[model samples]
Target: MGRFIALMILVIPAVIAGYGIKLMRDTIFTLLNTPYPNLSVQFIAGFILFLAGLGFIGGFIFHRDKKNGKIAPRFKRRK
Candidate 1:
């Protein structure tokens, strides 16, 4: 149950990241999405979304690694 919940939480960010990629690609191909007024807006929004999702996932993994002492010694909390 715990693992399932964790997976569900992760899925949302993954989907958001995927959609961001799609939006960026569309902008590059000159395909306009109605919700966005222009290519610049779409591209910017996509970039932000992609970074946000990536940051969240990266932070989660980093936290887990820190807890398990799997990361570099320099990153570990100092006593």
Candidate 2:
């Protein structure tokens, strides 16, 4: 189905991004000899994930619905 394909396309990038961020965080923590991640780093990483999810998931879902004409136009004037 188109929805499944769209979901996969959107999800793959976010998953890759999440994995890449985790790898980077681990590398930095190891190099810096930090036992725990900084709060700011944690917040930034979470924010990035949030944005990725919002953008991709929201975009695909909206696109699919719009493609099917499920979304109605707003603010139409009465005839």
Candidate 3:
């Protein structure tokens, strides 16, 4: 049950980010003939989603690995 919820949390943002990338790609191709290609909110939203999703996944990995001692603590000073 917990794992399912965790997977859902990771997947939802990834799906949103993927949709955003598709929207931006289509917008760019459709506007390729225009003299001045302008960016729409969809592009910005997609970028944000992509970054947020990456961050979430990275953090989850770090947390999980740290628990198993496979990775060092993020804030600990290595001497």
Which of the two candidates, 1 or 2, achieves a greater lDDT against the reference?
1
Task: Give the TM-score of each candidate.
Answer: 0.94, 0.51, 0.66
State each candidate's clash count. Answer: 0, 0, 0
In model 1, which residue pairs have backbone atoms overlapping below 3 Å? none
Between 2 and 3, whose TM-score is larger? 3
Residue 3 in candidate 2, Cα distance off native in Å: 6.5
Candidate 3 lDDT tens digits, 1-79: 9999999988987787676676668567754323324557656665776787778788887778777788756655489
In Å, residue 3's CA in model 3 sits off its true spot by 1.7
Using lDDT as the measure, the top candidate is 1
Question: What's the lDDT for residue 69 in model 3?
Answer: 83
Judged by TM-score, which candidate is best?
1
Model 1, span 46-76: residue lDDT tens: 9988998888888888998888889998998
**RMSD, every candidate, angstroms:** 0.8, 6.5, 5.0
Q: What overall lDDT goes with each candidate model?
A: 0.91, 0.64, 0.70
Q: Candidate 3: where is the Cα deviation over 4 Å? A: 31-38, 72-79
